[model samples]
Target: MIDTAASLSRFKRKTPRRVIWKRQGLAFLFLAPGLILFLLMIWYPTVQTVLFSFQNVGLTGSKGWVGLNNFDRMFGDPQFIIAWRNSIVFVLLSLIMGLAVPIVLALMINEMRRFASVFQLIVYLPALIPSAVGLLIWRLIYQPEQTGILNSMLKLVGLPPQLWLSDPNLAKPLIIVIMTWLSAGGSTLIYLSALREIPVEFLEAAELDGFSPFQRVWYVVLPLISSRIQIMLVLQIIIVAQVFTEPFILTQGGPASATMTPVLEIYNAAFVNSDFGLASAWSVSMLVVLSIFSVIYVWLRREDTGMN
Candidate 1:
């Protein structure tokens, strides 16, 4: 009897251990592919870029160690300053235009009882289009001549045709506009989803309390969706800070580097100038800035949530 009881107790303990081991093994098995891909695609490249930043890497291969020389050259370059300034401007503009517009649009759409689905599809259509294709289309619209869509519209209104992408003063704003148009749809959808998550009873109660449309949105809607707004704000900042394709396609950081962004400068350093080391250094600098931004965003989010 004593031997049987001891055997039963051992089996009970061993069974749980065996089950836990099996479950953990399955979890690791499921995670293995993603882990391998992350290491290969993200981790390896990041490590390589940091390593190459300290060394002179040429088109052929590794050249020689250059220590901080690449970073010094990058900081000293006038175009680098221009790129960084432009990146900051772009991020701020995106926050103002890109973030606010979508929220407003989403709020308006959420109020619509009829044709909501149609409105959603229409708004989201641009987001579904390939970014490269949309940029090319916008390029045609932004052409400086009278044949351009925007120029033609301006001419129809008896306004003088202006160089949209070629003018140094206009290029960056045009880029921001195009970016907002392209990106607003998806953000609007996200905002709409968050709006749906709000309790209908709260909205109704506010309405009964004589809350105006604007007041309801400002007080009730904004607070409930503030988390999503913060998330989107951070995402927009990261994206706009690293903007490359619009400037690359529309202006090529041209018209006296007006549209030049840090990422654009990095691309020019690597491919155009064949200075991989300098490019890697620029990349590392950008990474550091983004990391700092992310940390600050997290801290702010924690504080906001704690206060709530």
Candidate 2:
């Protein structure tokens, strides 16, 4: 009887160890593909970019080590300065237009008692469409010709057709508008999801305290959703700073380079200009600048995770 009891205890211990080993093996099997892709697609390129930024990488291959010269050139270039200025402007405009639209829409949508799903579908439709198609649609609407939609409206008012994308002053703002329209839908859904998670009693409590509707939103709702807003603000800055598609498809950084951005400049340096060395330098510079915002975003999310 004693021997049998000892055998049973040993079997129990060994069974749990085998089960744990099997679970770990399964976990690693599921993780292996993602790890391989990350190393190949993301990590490898990043390492190459860092290495190439310091060296003189020609079209064929690396020429030699030329430390700090690329950085100096990037700083000295006139177009690069314009690119940075434009990137800053993009961030500012996105904060004003891109960031607020979603929050406002989410707030309005949250108050709905009926047909909310219909409104959500309508709002999110723009995002569901391909970004290229959305930009192209705007391109047609903003066409500088008299036959174009906006120009046709102007013609009806006995006004001359204005150069929309070709006007240096108008180019950046117009592109920003397109970006806002395209992005607002997706962002609204995010904020709406956050709004839905708020407890009902909180709003009721605010009303009982005799807070007005505006006060309820401003004080109660905004405070509750501030975490989402904070994280989105950083993300918006990061996205706008590296804006490529809007300018690339619509203006191609034209209208006297009014819509020129850092990413666009990097692209032009690599392919259009055939100067891979300069392109790598530009990429590194953008990485450094944008990494500040990235770190802020990560830290904010980490705080959120910890709170949860």
Please provide TM-scores, in order, for all candidate models, with all chains considered together: 0.90, 0.89
Worst 10 residues of 2 by lDDT: 299-308
lDDT of each: 0.89, 0.90
Query: Candidate 1 — which residues are off by over 4 angstroms?
Result: 1-23, 296-308
Over all chains combined, what TM-score does candidate 2 have? 0.89
lDDT per residue (tens digit) for residues 1-308 in model 1: 99999999999989999999999999999999999999999999999999999999989988999889998998899888898999998888787767898999998898889988889888998987888899999999898987888889998999999998999988888888989889899999999999999999999999999999889989998999998888888878888899999999888998988988889888888999898999999999999899887876777678657853
Question: What tens digits encode model 2's per-residue C-alpha lDDT throughout 1-308?
Answer: 99999999999989999999999999999999999999999999888887888888878889998898878889899998899999999889888878889999998888887978888888998887888999988999999977889999998999989999999998888988998888899999999999999899999999999999999999999999998999999999988898999999999999888999989988988888777788999999898998899989988999657853
Cα RMSD for candidates in order: 3.1, 3.0
lDDT score for residue 60 of model 1: 93
